[model samples]
Target: MAKEVYQNRIELLQGTLDLLILETLRWGAQHGYGISHAIRARSGEVLQVETGSLYPALHRLERQKWIASQWRLTEQNQRAKFYELTTAGKEQLVRDRSKWEAMVQAIAGVLGPVPEPEA
Candidate 1:
């Protein structure tokens, strides 16, 4: 059952990770673990952002100057790097969201409505 549930998860595309990370940071500054938790919670467990993918995205976003990070102690008193969106990141979020919405609409159009089940 757990394996089936795990298998149902969706894998994120290359650009989508950056968008999700930026949107997650929009709420406020968060450590890497916190960021992943927030995304999983918000996605209702359907989207699991793996650490392998998450860290590289974090580093890339940092290099892009879309987010800034600082070392901070978590609630558990453990030290971690917290990241927050920069002004440019906020702008990028807006742009990415627009593109995402448009892509969703385009895909939906191509797929059309779902067929009804037979009685």
Candidate 2:
């Protein structure tokens, strides 16, 4: 028997990742690992945010002042930097959410409703 190899071809575009990161921060402050874990969990493991990709995104959002970071001790008593959304970030989230909803609705309209299955 041959084993099947799975691949993920979707690469999040330049700013999309920042948007997702910001949305995650909307819940509250979280460290790098916490953010990645929450996203994966919330996505039901369908989306995996790699550390290499996540760290850079966090730094970029921080640079843009969309998110703020501070050092804090984790439950394990280890020091780590946690991030939270700024007021500007909350506004951005509202805008992004609207944009995403519109895009999804547009795509759904193109696809049309699914046909009913036979009883």
Candidate 3:
């Protein structure tokens, strides 16, 4: 059904919001809403990040010094906090990506051919 297909379109982000946010900021500084839109747009509208998750991750990244933020006015003149990746964030992103690739490979290995039962 169309509803089932729509449900399938959304997937659990599974602790990757940090990586996603970091990756998103790589392009340039953006406000919170802008970051969310960018991620959804990039993911073909499948990865819809909720505000409850997004803001906390942003703050956590800020505390960890992986990202930096500043209050800025949008084109519409609304005040919002814009986040950008730091030097440390860039390095961390590289590490995260390596880890992600390793995880995918490991899962793929587990999903590969099963051994035949001994007689």
Candidate 4:
């Protein structure tokens, strides 16, 4: 049962890593591992982003100029490529969040009759 829940969450997170990554960086710059760990932590361990997917997505986002990366030394004095959102990325994040929110609403509607929130 726990395995099933984890698997389902992984499936859901696959489609949202880009958005989640962007959102995580909104707090500040992070290296690849930090970013993935942050996502997992923020998602309450529901999302464990695999390196197989994460590195490619980071490269892709860097290519798109949605994010920029630079080498920096961590507190441990180890060099790492830290990624931070660009102005374009911030703009794109806003648009993407709106679209994501709309998608959630549409999916919820399809799922049917969620109880309305009290005002």
Best by TM-score: 1
Q: Residues 9-79, candidate 1, lDDT per residue (tens digit)? A: 43336679999999999999999999999999999998899999999999999999999999999999999
- Global lDDT of each model? 0.92, 0.85, 0.90, 0.90
Give the poorly placed runs of model 2, Cα more than 4 Å off: 1-12, 113-119
Clashes of each: 0, 0, 0, 0
User: Which should have the higher TM-score, number 1 or number 4?
Assistant: 1
Clashing pairs in 4: none
Per-residue alpha-carbon lDDT of model 2 for 1-119, expressed as tens digits? 12222222223354567778888998999999999998899989988899999998899888888899999999999999999999988988888888778878989988998878999
Of candidates 2 and 1, the better by TM-score = 1
| Every model's TM-score | 0.84, 0.81, 0.81, 0.82
Off by over 4 Å in 3: 1-14, 113-119
lDDT of 4 by residue, 56-112 (tens): 889988988999999999989999999999999898889889978998999988899
Candidate 2 or 1, higher lDDT: 1
Among these predictions, the greatest lDDT belongs to 1
Whole-structure CA lDDT of model 2:
0.85
- Evaluate model 2: give its TM-score: 0.81
Candidate 1 lDDT for residue 4: 67
- Off-target runs (Cα >4 Å) in candidate 1 are 1-12, 114-119
